[model samples]
Target: MDHRFVGTAELVETPSVAVVVDVMRAFTVAAWVFARGAEKIVLAGSLDEALAWKACRPDWMTLKDGPPAPGFDLVNSPGLLRSADLGGRTVVQKTTAGTVGALAVKEASLVLCAAFVVAEATAEALRTCESDSVTFVVTGEHGQAEEDLACAQYIARRSTEPETDAAEFLRRAARSRAATELEQGLRQGSHPDDGALCVELDRFPFAMVASLEGPLMVLRPCPTPSSTGAART
Candidate 1:
């Protein structure tokens, strides 16, 4: 796979298919949900939207979690998911960084939800695609960070020719403004519960793939490396 790791908004302009990463929390949790057994998933940009969707279709089933900023029900919580009954239902989720970044990349023909837990699965999945080029998009912590960069580079190292280390890429993308915003987010102490929930590996067979058509939260068991399959939570 010919892949490039791009660490900023500049990636929006890049023509290659982009894998939007929210590894520290968001996408990780989505992967976890798949492991549990969800039929489909949706990535919402706002709490209101997810909740409203849930209200309109109660039986459809939804996982409503996002930044507990304001007008939000709960932050992303993995512990909560473990106990809840998804029953192959659909989830509408938002988060501090994950969903928003995901929404931005939804325009891509193939937007695969990604994180550290499924790093190898994700990397290997992308390597099999027909796209001549792929890009790892770290939407960043707040907007840029070492962690998301590291996660993206993780894929870059495995599937592409990486020109930079995780830290360097983070430094290049972590602007003073973005860093301050990211720091303020840490101080808010708003979504602690959600962080712990999204870190499980191969937790979900669902890939949480998104697109202009909408999010396709495909659910299944862990892909047999021999089968080489991947889908969204």
Candidate 2:
């Protein structure tokens, strides 16, 4: 346990760490939640857990879930989060993949959210930080979604080769062959924009990493678009 980087699957060993990636949509939405400005987030592994949390603290949270059908108050759509008033509110999110992995690693010394959007920062943090192990957690369709794998690959590239063209690697990741392979793996299939949107880098900087406690997740300020240059930092 020298370093831990989370990917989509169970785990892997790196030069000084392990990476687990869930690139599809879980971490994607996490970036949004922070960008949109939520005071806090709570990750729930199951629908029942999410509901119970919501029930106990009705005023503190809203629910997010999804898939083939709409089953919760709000789905895992980042677009929806922007306009929602999550001020001083806690969001209890139950995803098909992300939350499950998050639930298992309640003891990650440094559990940061990993997605296409937060890939750069994750790499940077790892390069400078000191940890026994680094884990990359990918929240995808229960081991589906090649987007996360590609993101993992990109992260691997960055951690190993700081001089590599990060942008180009990300670009290649955006349209990876794994995307096609993972899609083909899905029998019923995934969402329409699952592949396209998952790979968009830095769409929002809000990086939501997990805490070493019950259900809580942390938010990190992501670099915003430069052209606009509106909000400072």
Candidate 3:
């Protein structure tokens, strides 16, 4: 399969499959939320869109950028999701990079949100899809973030080599500029544990595949394919 990595979302074009990587936060938070049993997550391009979605469906949770909203059940933080009860609940989310990148590539035959948490599963899912080509999109904050690029490269490696070293990839990501910034933020008392959560690889075993449903980008989990076929009797 042909694979290409784009540094930012703006340059993304139609491909058989597009994987959006935002390991510093965004998609990593999504993975944890799903792991906590979130029924579904809707991706919005902006804070206004996320709030609007909340207005339309008052029962759904809405997460925005910046600090956590007073009445909101969750925010854009993986550390917060670690303690939230998301069972049987749906969430609407808007972030600076991840979701925006996913929404930007509506033309992709398949769209998958990727982070270290689901890296291996995402690779397996892409292999199962058998697409002729795949594109890994690094949805950095404003420009390119080293952490996102690292995660994308890790995913690309795994898509072809099932035995790729996740630990080595994460170790490298932790040394990136984005990770350093996050670590500094933690030291300054901003969600102290979030930095560690962001780099935790393979925390979840499912891939989060997205689909455009009306005005929302809906994400759902898919189990990884088994490595071996059934034996002949």
Candidate that scores best on TM-score: 3
- Sort all candidates by lDDT, best to worst: 3, 1, 2
Write down the worst ten-residue block by lDDT for model 1: 213-222
Q: Order of candidates by TM-score, top first?
A: 3, 2, 1
The C-alpha local distance difference test score for the whole of candidate 2 amounts to: 0.57
Q: After superposition, how far is residue 33 of candidate 2 from its true place, in Å?
A: 0.9
TM-score list, all predictions: 0.69, 0.71, 0.90
* For model 2, the run of ten residues with the poorest summed lDDT: 224-233
Task: Report the Cα RMSD per candidate.
Answer: 5.8, 5.2, 4.7
Q: Evaluate residue 48 in candidate 1 and report its C-alpha lDDT on the 0 to 100 scale.
A: 74
TM-score of 3: 0.90
* lDDT values, one for every candidate: 0.57, 0.57, 0.79
List candidate 3 segments past 4 Å from native: 9-12, 141-143, 186-190, 227-233
Candidates 2 and 3, the one with greater lDDT: 3
Between candidates 1 and 2, the one scoring higher on lDDT is 1
Q: How do the residues 111-157 of candidate 1 rate in per-residue lDDT, one tens digit apiece?
A: 77677666666666676667887777776554465557766766667
Best by lDDT: 3
